[model samples]
Target chain A: SQQGEEDPQALSIQEGENATMNCSYKTSINNLQWYRQNSGRGLVHLILIRSNEREKHSGRLRVTLDTSKKSSSLLITASRAADTASYFCATAGGGGSNYKLTFGKGTLLTVNP
Target chain B: IAGITQAPTSQILAAGRRMTLRCTQDMRHNAMYWYRQDLGLGLRLIHYSNTAGTTGKGEVPDGYSVSRANTDDFPLTLASAVPSQTSVYFCASTAAGPNTGELFFGEGSRLTVL
Candidate 1:
């Protein structure tokens, strides 16, 4: 059962363009996190936005969470070809010390140089 | 820093065979999780342990079992492999606390059950 669903399933953009991906969840969550996975590699934590936080940023990655709407968005500004990869949004709802997270199918972002 | 380590980077096994995927984390995090990734299925949790000596089932616990005898190790086992069990498995860990939800992931273990 996927708690979150990423929009656009896939996105292709030219280098230096901005890429935005949206995620909607089924239930209220404690926090939402974004992770990036390069081809054939492990996932790396990007950013996390708590329910109380509307937006957060790390380097060029920005995340926004709307608890009322049960949705979140990830934005990559001034993207580069190196930024091409699969992005996933994970939600952590009330329970289990927030250790357990539900991940979405993911959005594949391709940056063509 | 070798945050998380998963054994058997890839494996191929016949249906009905028993297989276990090993996972170990050097971070000493209190929580460990096993998730399976299939095409269009995203990542589904199979099991998790909040601490050593305790384990809990997640959304997709059927056909899978896990153990956390110690804080650093969480191993997932399949009693009987099936074709549907073929997928890439990821092991992750995180510190137990409020406002700490980042999960460190392993490279992943690809299993093919035929």
Candidate 2:
């Protein structure tokens, strides 16, 4: 079963604009992570926000997690053409390292240059 | 480069045939996983190994098997290929264990079973 569900199945924006995607999971999670995949390529780890962390940042990416709501949001500031890809949110089942995670359907983000 | 490597970048197999997907990581990660990506199913975990000699089943592991004979290698084998088994297989590894969540993924192996 899928643990997380991403909002806005698809989104399109100008290169300089900001793009936001939301994710909601059904069960508790150890951490929520976001990954990006270019066409016909493997996913690359983007950022991870633990249950204890409310928000985190890396470069132009920002992530916020709410354990109570079982939801997380990813914000891409100043999007670029290179940012065009599918973004996925995966949840690590709460409380252990070896525990498996479930992946969401993912949101396709297209940043037009 | 220190990263995961997968073999047979893509393959087309016949039904009832057996196939193995090879994965190797130089990062010395303790956790390795095999996941299949379908059009609407997202990425479903097939199997995983916490460390060398320990293998566990993920959400989807019916016709697949995995072995962790060493720290750097984890291979996923399909006992019998089926049409439904056609999908892109991904091999991932994480050194953070349960504490952190960052998976390093290989390019991927696309398998088409006819």
List the candidates' TM-scores in order: 0.97, 0.97
For model 2, the superposed segments whose C-alpha errors exceed 4 Å read: A94-97
TM-score for chain B of all predictions: 0.96, 0.97
Docking class of 2: medium
Which predicted model would earn the best DockQ? 2
TM-score, predicted candidate 1 vs. hidden true structure: 0.97
**Prediction 2 global C-alpha lDDT:** 0.92
Residue B63 of model 2, lDDT score = 97
Chain A TM-score of candidate 2 vs. true chain A: 0.96
Specify the poorest-scoring 10-residue window by lDDT in model 2 chain B.
Answer: B94-103
Where is model 1 more than 4 Å wrong at Cα?
A96-98
Residue-level lDDT of model 1, residues A1-113, one tens digit each, is 89999998999999999999999999878889999999887889898888889989888888888888899999999999999999999988755564678999999999999
Q: Given the true complex, what DockQ would model 1 score?
A: 0.65
Colliding pairs, model 2:
A30-A94, A97-B98
**Model 1 chain A — which ten-residue stretch has the worst lDDT?**
A91-100
The number of the candidate with the highest lDDT is 2
